[model samples]
Target: MEGLKECVANLVVYLHPSKAKCPNEAILTELSSMLFTYNETFEGVVLAYDPGNCSNLAKILPGIHPYFGVKLTARILLFNPKPDMLLEGEVVKITPHSIHAVVLGFSAAVIADEDIRGEFKYKSKHGKEVYVSKSHKKHKIKVGTILRFVVKSFDEEILHLSGSLLADHSGCARWLDKNSDKWSQADRF
Candidate 1:
């Protein structure tokens, strides 16, 4: 794994609890606006071992104090409305050096007024052809079918994820509350 020499370190520095510098109100306002529109609530933050930084530690540990080699932590947020509807045990296979993954056993429901149409699509790799319903009868998928998927990579230029999806889902709510402790109740602006 490529060690996160600067990126992880920078994230740790930015999320440090003792740090006084934080995102400005304007940025927070924008985030709140986006969250509200999406019908999702901001969750707390979670600290986890950064895989990238762990590589760097291996090379530097001999010269530095052994105690300094502990895994570095990265912060992530959790969202109420999952970025996508994913079922447990869904196989998520990530392509190395790419920001996309293949998800298996997934189905989506398209609800139209007075009628519900269930559409199924499966894509196993990025840039690959997606298999969709050619006939209505072909769309019948079991509840736990392993459907192929190509999810946007977290490290994509636009997504720029700080950590893994699981990490974000675990920590986002807590981080929001803890970081907002200094704000007054009326600071929702």
Candidate 2:
């Protein structure tokens, strides 16, 4: 808001089509500069682009603008997830049936009780008497536990993360050994 001149952000910019009308290099350079300037507001932020996330994401405004003969409107589209790697998150909810977690600035993910670890379960506090794993009696899933997971699946917004320590947890006993490195720094995540 400081030194910005009185530039009318019409949200519509017309582009020339052919080199006969406007040279390609000239248009490309000029348009690129304009786009980058405006797109600064969109940098590093996720936008609702698809119908899965928001149905009105790409919907046009109530006004109409025609270029030469064709009509034009605005739209919001998604960018790919960055770095293409596994991410860590905190388990926000722990239950007898499933574990709900969230990645930082992302979406909620789920790890079913059966999918959490190799044959792991905890007795529910309500005590309806369901099958519980005896081995997991010592280590129970609790809130705010940092869990490493991979993005199993994702749409525009929803995420399905899996806590499958496929390579790390080679065996049950090894898991206990690796995870029990120290109890002093419990809140490391």
Candidate 3:
């Protein structure tokens, strides 16, 4: 199924607060299913932010805002599917310095060593090969990995990267869409 994408102005997450009857597992499972469904049906782009979690909302929303393209707002509902399909334990955790978003079956790069003990190398955007510890190695990665990295530490230019490694030239953000007037404006100016 094709993924859904929509711009959201505000997302209101209803939490039970009391985890006695409605557990966090139930809540996260519902949320994940909803996100998957939304990602499959919507198009254009999607921007979601929860008002309840103000601090975290602030951090992620700003980072994703400029990439939404034309979408402005949207809403999605979440509900538990079944007992066996529930999400148990913490699915996402956010602290002052970092935010960790977890998925049950997340695939990431893993070492291909036969000895069961070795380091794995991952190439960063800067062309620097970084070695991951044996314990930190992953087997594969999902199409889009949830990174819990610090937003402040890295240089901002990395975020503006465009095009493939073969073509080191930039100014290709609107390359896929020839109808964009932004290109005309750039020519005129």
> Which residues of candidate 3, in runs, are more than 4 Å off?
1-6, 9-25, 34-38, 44-163, 170-189
In the range 1-189, model 2's lDDT, one tens digit per residue, is 011122212133333343325433433443345331224344322333211111112223343542222122334332223322344556677666766777554556666655554545555566432323344454444566665544454443333345442323211332345666532243364
Q: Which stretches of candidate 1 lie over 4 Å from their true place?
A: 1-73, 77-135, 147-189
Best by lDDT: 2
Candidate 1, 38: how far from true, in Å?
Answer: 18
The alpha-carbon deviation from the true structure for residue 150 of candidate 2, after best TM-score superposition, in angstroms, is 2.9
Q: Using lDDT, rank the candidates from best to worst.
A: 2, 3, 1
Quick one: best TM-score, which candidate?
2
- State the lDDT of candidate 3 residue by residue for 7-71, as single tens digits: 43333334333432543444444345444222323321222323222222211123523221111
**Backbone clashes in each candidate structure, one number apiece?**
18, 0, 14
Clashing pairs in 2: none
Tell me the TM-score of model 2.
0.39
Model 2 scores what on Cα lDDT?
0.41
